[model samples]
Target: MRLVSLLVVLLLSPLGRAAEQTYDVIVYGSTSGGVAAAVQASRMGKSTVLIEPGRHLGGLSSGGLGATDIGNKA
Candidate 1:
């Protein structure tokens, strides 16, 4: 759920271009989805960079959250 929410926010986020270097994909956050995106791109042979403006990473996963209930559909 968090990944999906982050992805939607990322898709709606603004686009940026870097002048110093080049990358096939530039993820602008340190959220789990952002890291996943950068990793998958690298695995697929694309140059990638993750620019985390904040001081943290891993999104809610870094906060020690637990799993949801068995019937969670949201």
Candidate 2:
């Protein structure tokens, strides 16, 4: 079983990773939800790869848009 798991990781690692890069989860957007989800997944003990084509994190939070128009906040 250990060997099988190792083999699986070896085989899938390349396809799952970028050139010389590896990540269990590749998040393309830096949205609030995406960051939260990635954090949650990491807490679950899984390798994660977060990638945001955009040049910033926190979708709107880092974008200087605080005080959401919504009626609730987490």
**Predictions: Cα RMSD each:** 14.2, 12.5
lDDT (Cα, 0-100) at 46 in candidate 2:
82
Off by over 4 Å in 1: 1-19, 64-74
Which pairs of residues have clashing backbones in candidate 1? Answer: none
Best lDDT among the predictions, by candidate number: 2
For model 2, the superposed segments whose C-alpha errors exceed 4 Å read 1-18, 66-74
> How close is every model to the real structure, measured as TM-score?
0.56, 0.54
lDDT of each: 0.81, 0.82
Report the CA-based lDDT of candidate 1 relative to the real structure.
0.81
User: Which candidate has the top score in TM-score?
Assistant: 1
Residue lDDT tens for model 2, 1-74 = 99999888988897766677667877778798999988988998889877898888888878866666557856
Cα miss at 27, model 1 (Å)? 0.5
